[model samples]
Target chain A: MSNKVHRRRFLSQTAAVAAVWTAAAKTPCRALAANDSWGDLTGRLVYDGAAPERERLVVDKDVDCCGKFDIRDESLMVGADGGLMNVYVYLRSKVRAIPPELQKTVEKQVLLDNRDCIFIPHCMKIWNSRQEFYIKNSDPVAQNVAFSPDLDQPANIVIPVDTDATWKFNRPQRKPVPIACNYHPWESAYIFPVDHPYVAITGEDGTFTIRGLPLGELEFQFWHERTDFLETRDWPRGRLTVAIRAGLNDLGTIKLPPVLFAKK
Target chain B: MVFFSAALVVSGCGQSESPGFRINLDGYDPAKVSQAQREAIGEAMEEFFGTPDVPRVPQELGLDAERIAVAAGPVEGRADGAQHGVYRQHCAVCHGISGDGAGALATTVDPYPRDFRLGVFKYTTTRAGAKPLRSDLRRILLRGIPSTGMPSYAQLTDRELAALVEYVVYLSIRGETERYLVQRVIDEGEYLPLGADVKEEVFDEAAVWAAESWAAPEQNPEDTVVVPPPRPEYTPPQRAASIERGKQLYASKNSQCVQCHGPKGDGDGENDLLYDDWNKPKIGVTPEETARLARLYRLPAQKLRARNFREGAFRGGGNPEDLYLRVYAGIKGTPMPAAGPQAGAGGVLTPEEIWDVVNYVLSLSGRY
Candidate 1:
């Protein structure tokens, strides 16, 4: 049989499973309510190995505006005590439930600013189910903002200096889409879209907290943007499949192994 | 002669299989694909994508899915994911099995094979800014792309053509869905060898997203021909004047025609090293890093080449209106800029000016 036929047959088989998943999610089980039992989950992701060297980007053009400050590469960033920073951790659960306190905090407009040719938060999240971007260009020169999203209209807009633009995704992206400036090739950042409230981006201390997670065998995904590519799609580096109860659960200070970043 | 040497230099360091898209189906990597994954992906494709003619899903979801069905006989595969159905035999040499425009003979072909996942079909009869009609796809399949490695399939029966078309649609949808899932894996916690518990759920979510995309108005528009405004009958002198006007317009700053398409429209323009939107935005990678990526991706440098308009190998279509639309919308996903007013404030060409340029381009290619 031709490869096309084989692929079709194969796709047909996979489509069946996909149909079931869609069919199930469409008519969601509303039984799990807000007040119906929530739990807290906290953890720290640290790299046991020495941190990678931070490369400085040379501002090729616009030296007057860009040459003001030294720019360190945000791409393979590591924090104090070998603590990994800017790592996005999200919980994958069908039941999207979070305490009211955390709900307000998570559902805020995500801001990504181009200050001195650097994206303010090198990494950010649309932690809430509702994800949007209020991108601003602080540089004197124009920053042509463009993003890679699979759905709807393409994200390409020129945000003039001191001005901002707003964009929203119809659905959560499969990965954090990279935002880039055409004018400044060196300026780039990633925005992760998440549907649930249990997602947290690790801070300088490499510590993270998802105040209210749907209790049970809470599943978590840990990802750092600069890690080596993996054979499997999920858990590019770290995965948390642990049981958490009604109270606090600290899966503390786990090592970010070198094998994950090992060159193939 | 200069262009020939340039081509040589581009592919000189490349291995025998340098322009990856050149070789036939023999080049497919049997290892990257797994049977279970293929079956799962295939099944998902069927449910979400369905045959183009009869989509298993709802109208709003998969209204315009490609349903070309070819009877290439029953193809089989080992536990590994590599399996060639109709695609590898006929199309994979030019378009990769993954449909990423990185086939074995890819580099040799000017204006690389279409990356289907971009969802931008060059040829179409539908309204401007809409997906091509099924007949458009069928026509391309049977007729074959002109002036390129793509060969005519006059020998293949219409049924075979249909199957090939259907498989291309299948690959397009499949590639798009895979990209979606990879993005999901980044956003969500799910990993490969999907957990038994969430496999169905994850597939369901992704399928829904995939179906919605396939069923989008842009992808499956049921529109009539977007005919251009009719041109006034011109006298011999008037025609001469229009062509003269067109010659100047082609070289205008806004047109930037001479920079890439060349003075004679032979595609040997001054700025030949242009990258498409996809490659242009790729940033911060060292040369070594880029090489590693290109190897994994099976793509050449993929610098955009100005079309040798003299060849009359318009990937969109050779019709006058097709040429008109090419100038109007400027072929989305390509470096070709939209010159018509529809391009908003940046648009530099008026309706009449656009037609003039169209006539001039046709004259150069001898298609006028």
Candidate 2:
């Protein structure tokens, strides 16, 4: 009887695997070329008004260790030129073909470190589900990382001082998942894990670049920690539909109003 | 109590319509899942796993249909004197027909009966965020949770016990799958009357993932199982010294045991306001919002208390090894973080240090 059950299970599992492959094959694919159709997306997010003063985080615990670090509010960071920091932009639609160079990033490990009781690289992008997400604690004080993803399995493990830990997501998440430290409530970070390689996070200059995307119309999602979804008048639910052309496709200086970042 | 129990059984059996598992909308925005969407979810669940009276065990889940058959259905004796409806006969009064834990007597208990829909078992041999082993469930059945209304089924035959264990797993998988389908429907915005595409893409994957989590402990014991190192025998003076060391580590920033467990282990931790993963969602942005959400979710949100070692009636087990595992893996869904090394990952405390802390905790409980 058990044998019969096993055989039936094996058959069903095999069918499921076949179905996944067929589904994968159905995704939109464009003609592959080294330099022909491949293009880069460049965009900048600027604050419409004067940059709000960054709030100073209260170092309640481990004052001797955490208080020394110049830790300001990381939820929103606008530079001198009004360039916003830590805005995530990623492809929503499925695309099969990818440039060879960008494909290599799937194997690379993305690092998120803890220094002076603060999560370094407050915002990060995990290019592909296959890539390992590594976390390190450079501080002398012990820190625990609570990684809770919406779709994937959640993990809340401790990262001892000077030691490191690694996590891997089983599937892509619809939105960036918050990585928080329960011990130190203020220590927080966000990780955007997607299956596709077309993902980027804005730097201090408020600019982001996705090296090689298929030259065609694709829907992309924009997200920020403060604002749940980077919704705009033009982009509903932060869904930006753009046509990727050959060479650099620069979306010239998109201005975001200060009202968007106002506390709800 | 006897009359109440009898009344419950009569009420349960007297129903004209068959009892079905409720579609868990707990912690979900009531507006998000429309009436039509709810109907779709109900239909999909029914299609995959039949009514509680007659279960359709998915082959991929590796559940024994014979075992499930022995456990499910209305209680009765056959001509041969063999028993059926083992679960309904013994457990349904408390565990409920669907194992939702909202039984007739659920509210009467201090700590409400555990809603297994979340798939978070508090006591388990497996590590944090992992499913309990079959053995772990069997152990609970035999010994039972000490302070809770859950009574030991020690008098039952091994076969009957085995059947109950398998049934629990089945119910858990079914419940978890229901949650997965709800998420898929909301996230993907699938139209009503979910099609073959959903069955293939969403339901199958959720079932397989859940089944695998249950199987992982047995399949890969090295990674999932927590094995405590041998406790070093201590003389009178040496034991005192070890306890002193543990006391320091407990207060140290490395463990931060004082923050939640309190400096005196009196359960009056500074951070008194704590909720487990299960109850956290029920809490809204404000008190008024929480009160409003209480209407949506039937059960009221309850705060989780960090264990007071001084009054030690450990839920998992009171043995030194159990304490060692607690400090090692931490309790799942609660604030207790894993201090000892996890599988393939570094941790704050070493095995020896964890044992020391365990010793300190034991001493606080006046066990030493």
Best candidate (score: TM-score): 2
Q: Candidate 1, DockQ to 2 decimals? A: 0.07
List all candidate RMSDs to the true structure: 11.9, 7.3
Residue B152, model 1, lDDT? 70
Model 2 DockQ class: acceptable
What TM-score applies to chain A of candidate 1?
0.78
lDDT of 2 by residue, B257-293 (tens): 8877899998877667677776766765447867776
Clashes of 2: 0
Native-referenced Cα lDDT, model 2: 0.77
DockQ of each: 0.07, 0.24
Runs of candidate 2 exceeding 4 Å displacement: A1-34, A46-60, A63-85, A105-107, A128-130, A150-152, A226-237, A253-264, B1-12, B77-83, B88-98, B104-110, B190-193, B283-296
Residue-level lDDT tens digits of model 2 in A165-205: 88777777778888877677678799888878788888888
> At residue B184, what lDDT does model 2 achieve?
67
Q: For each candidate in the order shown, give its overall lDDT on alpha carbons.
A: 0.58, 0.77
The docking quality of candidate 2, as DockQ, is 0.24
Judged by DockQ cut-offs, is candidate 1 incorrect, acceptable, medium or high?
incorrect
